[model samples]
Target: MDMEGEERIAAPRAVVWQALNDADILRQCIPGCQSLEWTSPTELAAAVKLKIGPVSASFSGAVTLSDVVAPESYTITGEGKGGIAGFAKGGAQVTLLDEGPETLLRYTAQAQVGGKLAQLGSRLIGSSSQKLATQFFADFNKAVVARAEQSVQS
Candidate 1:
């Protein structure tokens, strides 16, 4: 499956980039994120639980960021296994555009799944992926905006 989206955050590009890389911030924004830990400056270990259709499972994954151009863009790649439920692997290109006081984030991702999940068919998988992606970006934008507001108040 392929996914793409854009989000406008009411914060500077640098601030947005920092938030995206912060484990604490991501934990708040990502749905069902049990943990997000940085093993290295460019790598993160994460645990996520998800329910897709009738299947629910916990996934342990590692995400690596490469081709990084600070406050601008990076490539993220990761893979996760859900035992019998399935396994998923994907990569995404994320870009941040400075829009004066705000930042515009653009991302495109491609993912593949194996085992029982793939048997659910492409339509269901595609829609589920879209929904999850949408929710993630929405939550992330909200978190970033809230932080920006708090900064202004302080």
Candidate 2:
């Protein structure tokens, strides 16, 4: 499946980029993310629980960021396993654009699944992915905006 979207954050590109790399901020922004830990400068381990239609599973995953252009763009690749439920692997390319005092965040992602999850059909998978992606970006935007406001207040 493939997904893409863009969001405008009320912060500069550097601020948004910093928040994106912060594990604490990401934990608050990612939907269903139970925990996120940095294993290295460009690698992280995460646990998330998700429900798709009638299927529910807990997934453990590792994400790696590469091809980075500081405060501008990067590629994120990840793979997750949910035991009997299934496994998924995906990659996303993210770009940041300066919009005056705001930053425009855009991303395109592709994923593949196998096992029971794959049996669920494309329509279900596609819709579920879209919903989850939307939720994640919304949460991320809120977090970034809130932090920016707090910083300004302080």
Candidate 3:
């Protein structure tokens, strides 16, 4: 499956870039993220719980950041296993565009599933992925803007 979208954050590119690189902010923003630990500067270990249709599973994965250009763009790739549920692997290219007072965050991603997850039908899995990605960015945007507001006030 393939997915792509853009989000406009009410913060400058610098602030948004900081948020994107911060693991704590990502853990808070990602849906069902149990934990995310930085194993290296550009590598992270992740645990995520996902419920698609009637199946619920916890996935353990590794995420790597590559092709990085600070405060601009990077490519991220991850693969996870969910025991009996199956496995998923995907990669995304993320770009941050400076839009004056706001930042335009765009991503293009491709994913593949195998075993039980692949058995759940393409539509169901695709929609679930789309929903999760949407929620993550929305929550992230809110968090980033809220911190920006707090800084301005203080």
Candidate 4:
């Protein structure tokens, strides 16, 4: 599946970029994320539980960031195994644009699944993916905005 979206965050590009890289914030923002930890400067290990259709599974994955350009853009790739449930692999190109006082965050992603997940039909998988992606970004935006507000008050 393929997806794209953009969000306007009420913070500077640098602040938005920082939040994007913060494992703690990501763990909080990502729906169903059980844990997210940085294994290296450009890599993260994560565990997540998800329910798609009537199937529920826990996935463990490693995410790698490449072609990084600091506060500007990067490509993130991840692969996860869900035992008999299936496996998922995907990549996204994310860009942060400075929009004066706010930041415009854009992303384009592609994903594929195999095993039981692939058998679930593309429509189910696509809609589920979109919902998960939307939830993550919405939560992330709220967290970032709240953090920015707190920093200003500090």
Candidate 5:
């Protein structure tokens, strides 16, 4: 499955980019994330509990950041395994564009799944993925805006 979207954040690109790279901020923003840890500068490990329709599973994953251009753009690739539930592998490319005092964040992602998840039907997976992705970005945008406001206040 493939997904793409853009969001305008009320913050500078550099600030938003910093938030994106912060493990704690990302853990808080990610839906169903139980834990997120940076194993290295470009590598992160995560545990997430996900519920899709009637299926629920805990997934362990690793993400690697590459093709980076600082506050401009980067590619994130990850894969997760949920034991009997199934597995997922995906990659997303994100770009940041300056928009006056704000930043325009754009992302394009594609994912593939196998095992029980694959048996659950593409329509269900597709819709659920879209909803989860939307929620993640919405939360992330809110966090960035809040941080910007806090910084200004301080």
Candidate 6:
């Protein structure tokens, strides 16, 4: 499956970039994320529980950041195993653009699933993936704005 979208966050590019790299903020923003910890400057380990249609499973994976250009753009790739429920792998090219007092974040993503997840049908998997991605970005936008506000207050 493939997906792309953009969001305008109410913070500067620098602040938005900081939030994007913060594991704690990402853990809170990602739907069903149980844990997200950085293993290296450009690598992270994560576990997420998700349910699509009637199937549910916990996926553990390694996320890697590459083609990085500091606070401007990067490519994020990940692969997760979910026991019998199957496996999922995907990658996204993320870009951040300055928009006056805010930041415009854009992403292009591609994903694939195998085993039971693939058995669920493409329509189901695609919709579920879209929903998850939408939720993640919305939550991330809110978190970044709130964090920016908190920092100003401090």
Residue pairs in clash, model 6: none
Tens digit of lDDT per residue, candidate 4, span 109-135?
888999999999999999999888889
Better of 2 and 4 by TM-score: 4
Choose 2 or 5, whichever is better by TM-score: 5
How high is the lDDT of residue 114 in model 1? 84
TM-score against native, each model:
0.96, 0.97, 0.97, 0.98, 0.98, 0.99
Which lDDT tens digits does candidate 2 get at residues 1-154?
8999999999888889999899999898777899999999999999988888888989999999999999899998989999999997888899999999999999998988888899999999988888888888889899998888999999
TM-score of 2: 0.97
Q: Highest lDDT, which number?
A: 6
* lDDT, residue 123, candidate 2: 95
Best first by TM-score, ranked: 6, 5, 4, 2, 3, 1
**What is the C-alpha lDDT profile of model 1 across 1-154, one tens digit per residue?**
8999999889998789989888999888777889999999999998989888888888898989999999899998889898998997888899999888999999998888888888889898889888877898899999999888888899
Backbone clash count for every predicted candidate, in the order shown: 0, 0, 0, 0, 0, 0
Candidate 5 error regions (>4 Å): none
lDDT of 1: 0.89
Candidate 3, TM-score vs. the true structure? Answer: 0.97
**All models: lDDT?**
0.89, 0.91, 0.93, 0.93, 0.93, 0.96
Shift in Å, residue 152, candidate 1: 1.3
Number of the candidate with higher lDDT, 1 or 2: 2
Model 1 regions lying over 4 Å from their true place:
none
For candidate 4, the 10 contiguous residues with the lowest summed lDDT are: 129-138
Q: Cα-based RMSD of the predictions, in order?
A: 0.9, 0.8, 0.8, 0.7, 0.6, 0.5
- What lDDT tens digits, residue by residue, belong to model 3 across residues 40-154? 9999999999888888889999999999999999998999999999998988899999988999999998888888999999999899888988898899999999989988999
lDDT by residue (4-50, candidate 5, tens digit) is 99999999999999998999898998889999999999999999999
